[model samples]
Target: MPTAPAAEPVPSVPSPLIRAFPTAPPPDGLPAERESTAPAATGPASPGGDAARTAAPAVEDDADAARRAARAPGRREQRYQETRARIVDAAADLFADRGFDAVSVVEIAKRAGVVEKTVFNHFPMKEGLVFDADPPMREALLDAVRKRPSGESVSAAAGSFVVAAVGLLGAPEAAEGVARMARVIRGSRTLQVREREILGELTDSLAGLIAEETRAWPGQVEPWLAAHAVLGLYASLLELARDRVLAGVTGPELSGELRRQGRRGLALLQFGLAGYAKRR
Candidate 1:
C-alpha cells in the first residue's frame, strides 16, 4: 500500500428532459424558487420521467430535420418552374407566329423541348396557356388596393396600380408582344371572349374587396358601382394601349401617351365629369 492512486471525478450529464422542456412548479401553489432549490431524488425515476427523457432527443432531432427541409425551392421546384416558363414562352411564340387557334399543343411542346403531356400538365387548356399570367396579375391588383397607404382612397390605389402597369407596354420588347397579342385576339373570337371573361372576373373580385373594406350592408350596390367604374377606366386604358401598339407607337412616345391618358382618367374619376363636355 505504498502508492494509492486517487479516484478521478466523474462528469455529470444533464437530464435530456430538462434541456428540452424545463420543469415548472406544481399547481399545489409551490414557489418556483422552492422547486428550483429542491434536492434531487435518490430513488428511481418515475415512468413518465423516463419516457420523456427517452423521447426528448428524438423530438429534437425531428425538429432539426424539419428546419433543414423548410428552405426555399430545392432543385425539384426550381426545375418545375423553369419547365413551366419554357412551355409558356414556346406557346406564346408559336401563337404569335401563327394565330392561337393555328398553334397545336403538340407543336408548343415540341418547341419547348418537352412532351405534350408535360404541356398539358402545366396548362390544362390552350386558353389557359394564353392567360397564364391572370392569377398573379389578379392577386397583385387586389393586393395593391388592399395594402395602399393610409389616407389613400381605394380608387386612387387601383388607378395607380393600373397606370403603373401601362409601363409594361412601353418596354421595347413588349411592343412586339402587345402587337402580336392584339392581332391574335382580333383573329380569334375565343380570345376576345376570354379577355372579357377575365375583365368581368377582375371586376367581381375588386367589388368584393371594396365591399369588405367599406363594410357594406347586405343589399348595398355602392361597392359594385365603384368597382365597375374603376375597371371601366382600366378597360379604356387597355384599348388605348392596343390601338397605339397596333399603330407602331412604342418606347417613350407610347409611355408618354399612356401616362397622359392614365392621368386624365384618374382625374376624371377623382373630380366628377359633371362640368366638362357641356354646351358652352
Candidate 2:
C-alpha cells in the first residue's frame, strides 16, 4: 500500500481543434504576400528572376543589331562588284564597237544603266576600265615563275611563259580582243604611257624573281638588264602584231605572224645571249 501511494498523476492531452490552419488565401492574385507571410518556407523566389526579365529585351535588341552589322559588309561588296562589272562590260563593248576616243563617259554610263559618278567610283579614270581587264593574269604569271621546277633556268622559264602567253593571244577570239585593245591603246597616248609603265613594273618584278632564284647580288645590274632585254624583245613583237592588225591582219594570218616573230625573238635570246644569263 505504501508503494502504490507514490504513483504519479497522468498528464492531460491538448485538443486537436486548437491547431492552426493555413493563412487565408492572399487577396485575389497577390501570391507574394502569401509567400512572405507563410512560416519559414523550404524554397524562396529566384533572386535573378527580375534582373533576367528586365535584361531580355536589351539582349534581343543587341543580337538583332549584331546580325545586321555582319550582313552589311557582304551586301556592300556585292553591290560594288555588280556595279564594277557592269561598267567594265559597257566599256569593252563600246571600245570594241566605236573605238576608245570616240566613246564618252556619259555614253558608257547610259550603256551600263548607271550614273557617270558610279563609273568614276569604280574606275578613277577611263583608261583604268580598259587596262584592268585581266589583272589576275599578271598574278598568275608571277605565281608560275615563282613555282618553276628546280632545274629550270630563268630564261627557260621566261621562254615557256612567253610561249604560253603567245598561245593565249592566238586563241579563238583572243586575237580579235587584242586587235581591239591595240586600236584603243594606239588611239590614246595616256593609255600607251600607262601600259608602258605597267610593263616596266612587270619586268622589274620578273628581274627580282630571277635574282632570288639565282641568289645573285642585290645591286647586280645584269638581272635587271636581262629582264629589260627580254621584255623589250617581247614588247617589240607585240607592237609588230599590233601593226599587222592595223594593216588588216586576222585569224591564222595574225597567229602565224605572231608565232614567227615570237620564235625569232626566243631564238635570238637563246643563241645570241646564251652566255649572258645568270648561271644556276
Candidate 3:
C-alpha cells in the first residue's frame, strides 16, 4: 500500500503539432506580402495591351487600302475594251452596207452610240477598223506557215492552208459577205490600196516564216517567190467566190462550183508549183 501510493512522477508527453516560424517582416513602408506572386491585373488602358490592340487595326487598314489600289486599273482597262469593241462592230456593219469611203467616222460613232473621239481613241483611223475585223484570217494563215510540222516541206504546208482558205470561201454566208466586201473594196481606191498593202504584208510574213523554218536568208529570192505564188493562188480563189456570189449564185450551185475550182487549183499546186518550189 505504501509502494502504490508512491507512484512515480508521470513523464510529460511531446505534442504531435509542428511549431510555426515567423517570416521576417517586410521593409519599412512596404505593403503586406501577398499569398500569390502572380502578375497584377490589368485593364484595357494598360500600356503593352493598348499598343498590341492598336497595332492590329492599323495593319488591317493598310492591307485594305493596298487591295483597292490594285483592282482600279483592271476595271478601267475592261471598260475601255468594251467601248472599243462596240466602235469596231459599228464600223464593220457600216462598211458592209456602204463602202468604206462612203461612211464617215461620225456616222460610225453615231451608230455605235459613242462619241467620235472614242472611236478615234481606239482605231486612230477608219481603215484600222476593217483591218482589225479581218485579222484572224490572216493570223491563222501565218500561224499555219510558221508552225508547219517538222520534216514537212513549206510548199506542202502552204498548199494545205490555201485549201483551207478556199473551203472557207465556199461557205454560203461567207461567200455572200465576201462578195459584199469585195464590192466595197473595189468601189473605193483608198480601200483598194489598203487591200494591196494588207496582202503584201501577208506575203512578207509568210516569206519570213518560210525562211525561219527552212533556215534560209530572210531576203532570199526563193522564199519570197514561193510566198507570192501561194498568196496569188489564194487570191484567185477568193476572187472566184466573190464573182460567183455577185453574179446571183447561191446554195449548192455556188458550193459545187467552188469545190470543183478548188480541186483543180489545188491539184495544179500539188503537181506543178509544189514540185517547183521543192526543187528551189
Best by TM-score: 3
lDDT of 2 by residue, 109-173 (tens): 99889999989887887877776533433554456557656654455456545544553444445
TM-score per prediction, in order, is 0.67, 0.66, 0.68
Candidate 1 runs further than 4 Å off: 1-73, 273-280
Per-residue C-alpha lDDT of model 1 across residues 175-231, encoded as one tens digit per residue? 766777777777889877887888888899998988888778877887787677777
Better of 1 and 2 by TM-score: 1
Q: Candidate 3 has what TM-score?
A: 0.68
Winner on TM-score between 1 and 3 is 3
**What is the C-alpha lDDT profile of model 3 across 195-277, one tens digit per residue?**
67877877888888777656786467877877887777767766777688788876577657765665566565556445433
Candidate 2, residue 89: Cα displacement in angstroms equals: 2.2
TM-score of the candidate numbered 2? 0.66
Residue 180 Cα positional deviation in candidate 3, in Å, after optimal superposition: 3.8
Cα displacement (angstroms), candidate 3, residue 9, comes to 99
Candidate 3: the clashing residue pairs are none
